[model samples]
Target: MDPFEKMSLVGLRRYQAIVKAQLPIAFSHALEETTPWAEKALERLQKRENLVTEAIIKLEFGDDPDLGSQVSRSAAEE
Candidate 1:
């Protein structure tokens, strides 16, 4: 089985939080001109962050019957 499939809900949330916390650092690095590859790395990290966040939301609420409305409400709040 895949690592993500094996991860608990709490573990997935924690991992997502960790990735979010790293966004500031990644953004800062991306702003620097010294490292030519920093922007590419940051883009990859952002993509990973989106995937993890999506996974968390799916695992937490995908089974809910009102998932569409719930997601819309949550997205609005954000």
Candidate 2:
């Protein structure tokens, strides 16, 4: 078996059952704050650069075939 195929960075293996009992979809890789301020910053970056977009997230996880293959959308997407 591969070491990282199903690897989860932040799961508590010992307490997974307890945690799952409370929240069904606990995240593995956490995203930074997506507050209004962050959204505005993202917008500003997008305006300043051609490649800044939500699809970049998929590009960032490019090592994982499942996520990497999700592919990026055209920059013109709404």
Candidate 3:
């Protein structure tokens, strides 16, 4: 991979790890808030986390045409 791609993969991995680690804490806080907005925010975070995970998988395992489309869609949504 080119330097930029390598860096991007590293960054994505770091972000995925951070998000995975924080999810439980976030869930607890969201539950404590007990508001629709809090639930919505948590849901958004989970969606982003899934995208990052897919991106990481794509990078690590080489391209999958379907995953390429999925990643593109996720990026567009962002």
Task: Give per-model CA RMSD.
Answer: 3.2, 12.9, 6.9
lDDT of 3 by residue, 1-78 (tens): 333245478899788778878778779879899988878878877987877766676786568888677666775586
Error of 1 at 23 (Å): 0.7
Off by over 4 Å in 3: 1-7, 65-78
- Between candidates 1 and 3, the one scoring higher on TM-score is 1
lDDT of 2 by residue, 1-78 (tens): 432234342322323334334332222112256466656655544442332222243334555765544443433352
User: TM-score of model 2 relative to the true fold?
Assistant: 0.24
Candidate 1 weakest lDDT stretch, 10 residues: 68-77
Best-to-worst ranking by lDDT: 1, 3, 2
TM-score, candidate 1, is 0.73
The lDDT of each candidate is 0.75, 0.38, 0.74
TM-score of each: 0.73, 0.24, 0.65
